[model samples]
Target chain A: MAAEQGIDPIHQFRIEPIIPIHIGGLDLSFTNSSLFMVIVLGLACALMILGTSGNALVPGKIQSAAEMSYEFVGNMIKQTAGTEGMRFFPFVFALFMFVIFSNIVGLVPYSFAVTSQIVVTFALAILVIAVVIIYGVMRHGTHFLKLFVPSGVSPLLLPFIVLIEVISFVARPISLSVRLFANMLAGHITLKVFGAFVASLLGAGAFAVIAPLPLAMTVILTGFELLVAVLQAYVFAILTCVYLNDAIHPGH
Target chain B: MATTETAGTEAPGAPHEAAFPPFDPGTFSSTLVWLALTFGALYFIMKRVALPRVEGILQTRGDKIRGDLGAAFKMREEANQAAAAYEKTLAEAKAGSQALAQETRTRVKTEQDAKRKALESELNEKLMTAETLIADKKASAMASVGQIANEAASAIVQHITGKPADMTAIAAAIAAAKV
Candidate 1:
């Protein structure tokens, strides 16, 4: 009862500006979220650049990780969008590393979750869709519009089907961004609530006997959240490749 | 952009005073800028350096594996060729030895036949000489036996008549008795 009153699950999500900067009617202040992005950037780059520095035919641990990640993303793109989609491998790989590192880093005790923000995920999602749209238009010209025109549809339902397809296409970014943001947001909030339960239980004097239950649940949820972290990164990357596939082969 | 002042005002510790941190549209510019910069750096590094190096390493490893496999197959083929050669040599040696044995057997049989023929002809010559010597000795012994018998008869006549016997008459009587 006391834990529920004292718990502020939403407090962890507050994005405080680490270094405030205002320029030309823009508050482009560097926040905790930006710092984590840089951290993810460093980690991904370092792993790719330095881990492969040895260029070992028989790889060490770090090199194995780098090569495995490369092959994993390579195969994922190849499978989703075919070999022609390999052009977007770097883009998809960068996205995957950024998102996965963002998620994994956020799992640390006091780290900021960058992908948990709507703006951040939305930006990534919009970037993916922008590429798809630009490439589809440039490559296929007027034929790219055939994506919304499903085959075997009757004339009566064609307009309604086209409208629905367009709506879904427009909603892709929103859904993609919201899925990531909400998952991280909800999982962390739930973890915090359970942790608060343990803390409150430990403080409740007589109720301390049952504190281990919530602590155990938090541990289990952390593992589950770790899975979710990796899974979300995979989903985000594969979806990007799939959309790019649509661009590369628009008829399907 | 107009809400920059409002968000800047909310930049303090009490961020929730105005809006939930994520939904606050004012922070978009900052976050997007950072995303673009970091993501752009990652892409540049990946495209220029990381991906190519890994691809090269993979390519080298693949070539090495194929080379090693080819070498193994070549060695096996050489071994098979060597084994075949060895088998051929062994068969040739076996045939050669058999021919040598057959040649030795035939030569030894021919030598034995010559030696046996020489011994048989020499034995036949020796047998003929021995038979001639035995016949001459038997003829001489028979002449001596006749002389002894004539002497005994002369001596007996001398004792009975108290007179010498005649040699020519005796010889004539002996010849008549022999007939």
Candidate 2:
């Protein structure tokens, strides 16, 4: 019961560098966040390789899981971005697997959550938006700006509508990154707070009998957080696809 | 006591630092670098290895299914053709058997008519012989009946006269009586 003097819930989010490396006066040191990322990459790659290694017509469990994940992302892209969008299937699949793996791996006790950090999520969102903008311009030329202009609008309100559209368009990456970060951050914090409550109660001697309440709550919250973890990743990937759809099709 | 001391030492360090380290800009560059590196690596793996293998497996499975369905359809058509051929042969056999039965029936009828005609002619010949024999028998019986009548008439004449009747007279009387 180290919770005798209360617990610091924010301590879990701290970035402590594992290997300190400096280049050109910049701290490019590998941190706990980076370590977890490497672990996720290894796990993701291992799952795909081992699962598909057999490539049996009648699939084993691992192969089934691997194929199911492949179809899931493939279908998501096909539905949101159409068949033409399948060209980006690898990128979207990577983003989805990385986010989901990062979120799930973070659920392990004492593990650092990569997605909980704003910088990591923001970088991903920016990558998606940057691809969308670059490809939209290349494919659709100047007509890509039509994304801001609504069809069948009165000339009187056209400028106003365009302005609103532009603002929302610019806000895409911010909202995309923030939504994932906030959900993961909030869920983990709530879980920690409840865990600390249980610990504090257990340390209170006579009040120890009621410790099961917060403990039960923490267990339930953990289950809920797991769902949120997978769901937030899906949301991020789906929004990326939708944004890419605008790039490919523009306007409508 | 240890937890309290650690918490106290950490509480005085930052008055204006953001409550969440994620909001702190100090580690942004490093986080970005790692994200780019890991994501790029994962993307490369997905593109190079994982997806193509899965896609190949799916394509093979799809082709197998289509091939099986096509083979099944072809087999069904072959079965249908075989059944049709069997039915046609059955019908042809039935018609051949029917024609053979009809020919046999007509031949048998003609043979029976010829035999009946020959048998009727033979019976007619036998009936004619029987009629001739009956006519001969009737003539002999008539001759016997005439002789018996003459003898009885002569005996009765002799008894009444109490003398022998003359041959010539008797003969003449018998002849006149016969006439």
Candidate 3:
């Protein structure tokens, strides 16, 4: 009966291992999150292949679209991260593509939301943060630790300032993960609820002829979801750029 | 944060655990596995092929442009040098032509002056020879006139006396006639 209502949008957030395998007492089985991630990757690849296969100077529709997306993310990285930040562009671009692909794929029937899962999102966020820290430390040595110290602070206030900075710094992964997951989860849930409303209304026959309103709402919500998918990806990339800036320049 | 926390508390079950419908997690797992594979392959293609080709093309274009510019500069330099050399040769030719013309003019003037002097000296010698010939002719004529006068006086004496006159008288008559 619950399945007939279609997978509950809220229930879609649940993480369950596909394989019952346990390795060293840890269940490393493939999860629903992993499945959506694969779909997202496939979509990204197919899109990229279609885009670049023409290799036409005067690009066709697909190529132009791909080039546009690349330029868009590339410009954003350049603007926020500066020229030095260009080194991280590929990773950022990939990250954005993956998030966007996943979100859109999640809109498909019977698909799981990869971003809705905390573990996956958290893993990605941690990877970014780890890279920033490792790269920063390697590049700047002990000076990387100097990121906490503000230049103009009073000596008495320096301690409090450093503490606040440390807390913010530690909160990076949390914020990054939460932002993606929350946005995906909320958007999907809203889309589902609207979809459910239309389905329920249409079941009422002539009495619920107004069911088309919910259907229209669903279409509108779907469009909004697509927008959110793209927006979330952009936001994620920009945040990464900002974080990279911090890593490169530190306190400033 | 409180709103999120409250919402989270209300939505705490694995949406798949509901038994009325068997929630297949395999689909999700399969999708994820394929996504990872695709992502890996695409990333590889980008790193290995597309990016390198684009970079190569850009580099080739840059090199071609630079090479063309270098060639143009070299050509321009060569043309300039050729023009300079041509101008120098032209100047030399002009100088040579002018020198030749000047030398020819001077030689011609010298030759004309020598010819004019020779002509003038020859003309002066011809005038002296003509004057000498006229003087000799005049002297000879005077002598001839004296002799002719003597003959005529003798003839006149003969007619008057019907006898031949003596040499001393004749000479005296001739001398008087001559006076």
Top candidate (TM-score): 1
Q: If scored against the real structure, what TM-score would every candidate get?
A: 0.87, 0.81, 0.62
Cα error, candidate 1, residue A84 (Å)? 1.0
Q: Interface RMSD in Å per candidate, to 1 decimal?
A: 4.1, 8.8, 8.3
Return the clash pairs for model 1, or none. none
Candidate 2 Cα outliers beyond 4 Å, as residue runs: A1-6, B1-19, B24-26, B130-179
Supply candidate 1's per-residue lDDT for B64: 94
lDDT of 1: 0.86
TM-score of 2: 0.81
lDDT of 3 by residue, A1-252 (tens): 226546365665655567554334333356666556666766776666656676664567866666666678778988987889878766777777778887788777668777776545665677678778987998899888889998988999999999999999999989998998888878878877877777777777884788888779878888888888888878888898899887888767
Docking class of 1: acceptable
lDDT of 2 by residue, A212-247 (tens): 999999999999999999999999999999999999
Those runs of model 3 whose alpha carbons end farther than 4 Å from true positions after fitting are A1-7, A14-26, A30-32, A205-207, B1-45, B53-179
The ten-residue window of minimal lDDT in model 2 chain A covers A1-10
Candidate 1 local lDDT, A159-183, one digit each (tens) = 9999999999999988888999999
Q: Specify the highest-DockQ model's number.
A: 1
- What does candidate 1's lDDT look like per residue over B1-179, in tens digits? 12122234434332346677677666776777777777788878888899888888888989999999999999999999999999999999999999999999999999999999999889888988888878888888878867976897688777787898776777778878877
Q: What is the lDDT of residue B32 in candidate 1?
A: 72
